[model samples]
Target chain A: MISYMLCLVLFSVGLYCILRKRNVIKIIIGIGIMEYAANLFFVLLGYRTHGRSPIYAIDQEIKSMVDPLTQSVVLTGIVLGLSVTLLLVAIAIRIYERYGTFDITKITKLKG
Target chain B: MEISFIAIPLASAFVVAMIANLDERIQDCIACLAALATLTLSLFAITVLSGAGSSGAIVYKVGGWVPPFGVSIVIDGLAAFMLVTVNLIALAALFYSTGYMKKYTDKWKFYALFLLLLAGINGVLVSGDVFNLYIFMEIAAIAAYALVAFGTTAEELEASFKYAVMGTVASCFIFLGIAFLYGYSSTLNMADMASVLASKGPSGALLLASVLFLMGFGLKAALAPFHAWLAYAHSSAPAPVSAMLSGVVIKVLGMYAIARIFFNVFGITPVISFMILTLAVLSMIVGSMLAFVQSDIKRMLAYSTVSQIGYVALGLGVGTPLAIFGALFHLFNHSLFKSLLFLNSGSIERVAGTRDMGKIAGILDKAPLTAYTGLVGALSICGVPPLGGFWSKFIIILACIQAGRPILALTAVVVSILTLAYYFKSYTPVLFGNVTTSKQIKAKSLFTMNAPMVALTVLVALAAFILIPVVGNVFMDGAVASLVRGISYTDVVFEALK
Candidate 1:
């Protein structure tokens, strides 16, 4: 329960970075942090107190195993997160080229 | 054949990307043909479902895996209905982009992203598992963010950055929600999870998961309070991308997910309905008012999308069969007319080289096709009496009244009127005035651009009659029945598997 609370606290910190940061790169990092928090929570959900690795071998006997499904889901989530991060970074680079600033406030060409 | 809905688009996107060395025109044909193929399959799905009756669905288990353990592609009334809407708009956007994309240097890249976007949308609509749904949602969302910044202009990049950041946060919320649900039910299959959730009754974890999903999907759909990113994103992207984004992305990823999960998976509680109703009311009033104040043409349309989504949410919030039917019908109509309107704006921007409604005066003579078709789109979106939009808003309000929510019904009616006011005020300067300014409209309205507008105009006019029993049987009723079935959806999928 405490670990779950820790995961959510990390998630909240990322949300704060997204909401409060002015630099585009910092916000992208925040996005990465948020994704990892969710990934960590998924890991926690599948964990057993003394769980063995979820692997199969004809020669070995297993008493208990962690949920393999959440591990696989986390792996997929990480790849997706990488794609998002790379795209965000690429867009940030292009933004710097156009506006010549990292500050989001100065990037006001799209305002109402 | 169920696999064809996804495979064809995926193959076409791959083909488009691989042939980057070839002439750009080839990729355009590839994208259109891919869209046409899925549309044919979508039509086929409808025919098959209409005959199979209520419990009938097309269930395709990936790699020959069974329902609960593998990624199952299930096409039911709801999925089929959404498929048709998505593919239809996708086809139009592909055709429009052929002409519209010439202004940009690289055409092949645009077709690649566009087809991938279609593939992602189709994947979302067809997948029966929450995990698959998340994967596809990311695919579509990522494609959309990249396409929005395709111009590489400062404004487009700014909008894309903001949209991407907010979208990432929303997705994380959704991902965490999925984790919570997984922990509670120990299954990612939506139908199976629905059964588990039903058997478990209400719990604290379920409550948290639902609230997290509400925030995630609501932000994607751009509900009133979470709608800061939409105006800039819509106004900044190229027009066809704008059309696709506004037309179906929000509906499939946001509204459709909300309806499917809340109604089917989680089973809507009084608390859930109350929360949805609150959001609906706020979205309707705020979106329309904000839209009315916007000077940019696409931004105005974007805000109106927020308002229109409110109507759909209101119907879902009411949670009666009639209201869900109204909501689905309105969703279909909005996709058509909104895409038409966005396409029209693209054409206007292409010819006049500007999107400022105040400046592009009296374009009827300069671009007759855009002016006339845009008028149809404008009227349709405004919910004019004979057009499709009117029927949807009327039904939603009627449902609210029947559900004994007079205040909500009144809100829907007033918001509909507000919709008319904004469309009227904005289009007056755009369509009615004479071209007296020095801006020489340099571009000619081409056949590629005008064709989609005309096609969509005819569709917009005819979309109103779709709710009639004869047509609705094939198109709308299946969608409503599937949702009405709710938790029994698991039985339907299991039955189809056998």
Candidate 2:
């Protein structure tokens, strides 16, 4: 229960950074943090009090195992996060080249 | 055959990326051919599904694994309907891009990303596993991010960055919802999850999951308060990209997912329905009101998209069979006219050298074809009678009244009129007034660019015929029936998997 609360706290922090940060890079990091928190929560959902690795062997008996599906899904989510982060960083670099600043407030060329 | 919807585009994207350097024109040929092929497949799927009846959904398990264990692709009435709408717009936009993208340096990269985006949209339409759907959504979303930034202009980059950040946050929320759902049901397959949710009944966890999903997908669909990213993202992208973004991306990624998950998987509760209704009404009023004042052509169209999507959401919120039918029909019609309008704007931007309506005038004399098509698209979107938009709006309002929501029905009517007013106010001066610009019009509306607009114009004009009893019974009724069946989707998909 405490771990879940901690996860929510981490997610809130990331959301705060995303909402409050001025630097494009900081916002990207914030996105990464939020994604990590979600991923952590997913892993926690599958955790047991003393669960062992989810593996199969013909020779050995398995008693308890953590849910492997959430782990695999989280791994996929991490890959997606990596791609999004890489793309965000790449775009940030291009933005810096054009605007010559990392501050998002100054990058306000597009408006209604 | 079901997998071919994803495989063909994926392969084509790969080919475009690899062989792009060999020849400049080859990428264009490949991308168009791939889009055409997918469009053909979607048409075939539609016919097959309609012929097979409502119980005839096809479930193709990945690697021959059954549900609750392996991923599956389910092609039902709704998927088939959405597939046709998505592929049709995709084909037109790819053709338009061939000409419009010549202004940019790297045409091949654009085709590559475009095909990748198509692959993602098709994948999202057909996937039966919730996690698989998320993966595909990410694929489409990432490709869209890159495409939005394709121009590398300052405005485009900033818009793309903002869109990317907001979109990613939405994805995180969606992922969190999925995690909660997986934990509750102990399954990732949508059908299995639906059955589990049904057996378990309503719980706090499920309620939380639904709210999270609403926030996430609502942001994606640009519903009401979550719509800030749309105007920037849709207006700043290249015109064809904007067309695809407005035409089908939001519908498939945002609206379709919402309908499938809320109505089918979760079984729409009264609370959810009420929440959706409130958002729909808010989006309808606010979006059109915002659109009325935009001077930029694409920006107005973008806001109009937000407004129009409200009608779709309203229909879904009403949750009557007729209302869902209206929503689906409007979804198809919007894709047609919206893509046409955006493509027409691209042509105007190319020839008139500006998207600012104040600076451009007398398009009817300058580019008669573009002007006429834009007029048709604008009129259709404004819900003019005998055009596609009118019938859908009529049905939605009628459904609202039938469902005993008189005030909501009244709002729909007034919003429809407001939609007409704004579309006319923005487009009339550009299409009909005297030539007023001092800039030299390039006058190079190429055949490739004009062809798609003409095709879409014809579609926009003729789409109303589908509302006839004979055609609607055959095509639209199937989709309506599937959604009306609601959580029975689980049984149908499970039976198909057998």
Q: Write out the backbone clash pairs for model 1.
A: B362-B433
Candidate 1 lDDT score relative to the true structure: 0.91
lDDT of 1 at B419: 90
Clashes of each: 1, 0
Q: State the lDDT of candidate 1 residue by residue for B253-354, as single tens digits.
A: 999999889988988899999999999999999999999988888999999999999999999999899999999999999999999999999988887888
Highest DockQ scorer: 2
Model 2 chain B worst lDDT window (10 residues): B47-56
- Per-residue lDDT for B245 in model 2? 99
- Native contact recovery (fnat) for each candidate is 0.96, 0.91
- Full-model lDDT for every candidate: 0.91, 0.93
What interface RMSD do all candidates show, one decimal each?
Answer: 0.6, 0.4
Tell me the deviation in Å of residue A105 in model 2: 0.9
What would the per-residue lDDT of candidate 2 be over residues B1-498, giving only the tens digit for each residue?
Answer: 999999999999999989967876788889999999988988887778777444658789899898879999999889988888899999999999988898899788898899999999999999999999999999999999999999999999999999999999999999999999998999999999999999999999999999999999999999999999999999999999999999999999899999999998999989999999988999999999999999999999999999999999999999999899999999999999999999999999988989998888888888899999999999999998999999999999999999999999999999999999998888998988788557567767999999999999999999999978887766787688779999999999988766
